[model samples]
Target: MAGPEVTVVIPTVGRPSLAAALAAIGPGPEVIVVDDRRDARTPLPVPDGVRVLATGGRGPAAARNAGWRAATTPWVVFLDDDVVPAPGWAGALARDLGGLPGHVAGSQGRIRVPLPPGRPPTDEERNTAGLATARWATADMAYRRRALEAVGGFDERFPRAYREDSDLALRVRRAGFTLVRGERVTVHPVRDDGFWASLRRQRGNADDALMRRLHGPGWRAASGAPPGRLSRHVLTTLCGLFAAALTAMGAHRRRAGRAAARIAGLAWLALTAEFAWARIAPGPRTPGEILRMAVTSVLIPPAACAYRLGAEVALRTGGAR
Candidate 1:
């Protein structure tokens, strides 16, 4: 079949890599680049023949909605600006979509994350590598336009790109369309991030809570997601807080309270140390890496718990469900 049956939609935030991504796509499909950059001061520039749409700084879900909504193709393929399509990926994608069955609503392209050379991958690298096994991420995914429309496209409630794709995939599946993996490959290089990057990522715990509220508690099992460590986090955080309270109460010379506080404090320290060591063992073991892992591990459980609690309140009170 002559190509162009699939329209490529890329939602970008003015990343410099966008040009390379477009270049690697190699001329076969109608390409639309949706600029989601909130900075209205400067516009994203694109090459000739590639259409550009501005979403006025909305998140990617909105940018993607605009992209696909403007497209007039049977299949709308989404690619992240940070990824580069492998050689001949366009031809492979054309075939990937064209060969799909009626019941197949979306096809995910295979993703390869190149790790840093000469060291066991740090926790960040390991996390980035998990994208390869992700069931459905839009780094390179093509969906039947009709299926997208039927599910009302990506949910804008998920402001961050973290869970938005998974939310859409879940809804698409619930609408009775199965998603399949495709042969097309894309390279999603791990970008450098701040020391607190992983720590800040705990904000996604709230997204997980929203997912549970919208899809029910069984959503994880239904979606094939592994059981997470939320329960352990909750226990760790509570133990830490309890230990602190007991220590404070015993400050006034109460012997019994002091003994209890000592026991609880030891338990908290043991859990924190064990969590930190697990992250440290697989790391590069540099001083900075060790410090980051130890500090973040101590902080993550409480932060995650707090986010989950906040999400429960927000979702239950009609916030972002």
Candidate 2:
């Protein structure tokens, strides 16, 4: 049987990075860009010969589904607007797809984040490119159109950027198909943002909770996600604080008060050290970056836990799919 024709689908928030992505594709492959932004805000001009579809501000998951549905080809490669394919990417993809077994439903490419020399990755850079190994982002992945149809495309319940790709990949795997890693590579350019800006952008925790509800408590770690050390840190910090407060109120009971205060102080220091070292030891940073890390470190634990808890609760309560 002949291999199916490939169509490239990109979902963009109208970032300037789209131009780089467009320039990377080979000639004659049908490329569709789903514009998720409500207004024309991207500074990059649309390349000629590429089709642009407006999604009326729907999220990436929805935009991806729409884009795939509009594609006439048998295979669709989902590329993020922020990603640029490497040289010969299309040929590599075509060759890979042609040799795929019947049970293989999708393929994911390697994503390399181009960071400045001598600079450690910022939290934002790490988050944007998903520095963790073992899981593939939709930015450089391709899916079989038939498989997508069978699984009903991406789960729209994943409102934010996180977990949606994993969720889809999980479902696809469960349907008795293999998702292979391909030789096709893409460069995910690191975006420049302040420490606080990156922290504020983590609205995906809610979607993560939803994923847990849909999959299970083991979903995070099972899906190649890092351990929820942040959750543990937050819990420990809260316990320490409570112990200290109780001890302060019971100053008349000197023995217990002293013990409680000691425990609380120890816990607080431990959490602080862990947070600071994680950011600092990765690489050399400017004084400003170090200060930002120190300040943001205190806030990340609670913020992350809260988002995870909220997401799990909402999913259990049937708030989102």
Local accuracy by lDDT, each model: 0.88, 0.78
Candidate 1 per-residue lDDT, tens place, 241-305, comes to: 98889767665267777777777778888888988998899889999999999889999999999
lDDT of 2 by residue, 1-321 (tens): 234588899988887788888998877579999988878565336778788887867789999999999998988999888888999888888877887887999988888877777667666666665642548578888889999999999998776667789999988988998888888778888786665874675566676667777788888775788765656656656865676687668752788667777777778778777777777777457787788778877776667777777766766676554
The candidate 1 region of ten consecutive residues with least summed lDDT is 247-256
- TM accuracy, model 2: 0.88
Q: Which residue pairs overlap in candidate 1's backbone?
A: none
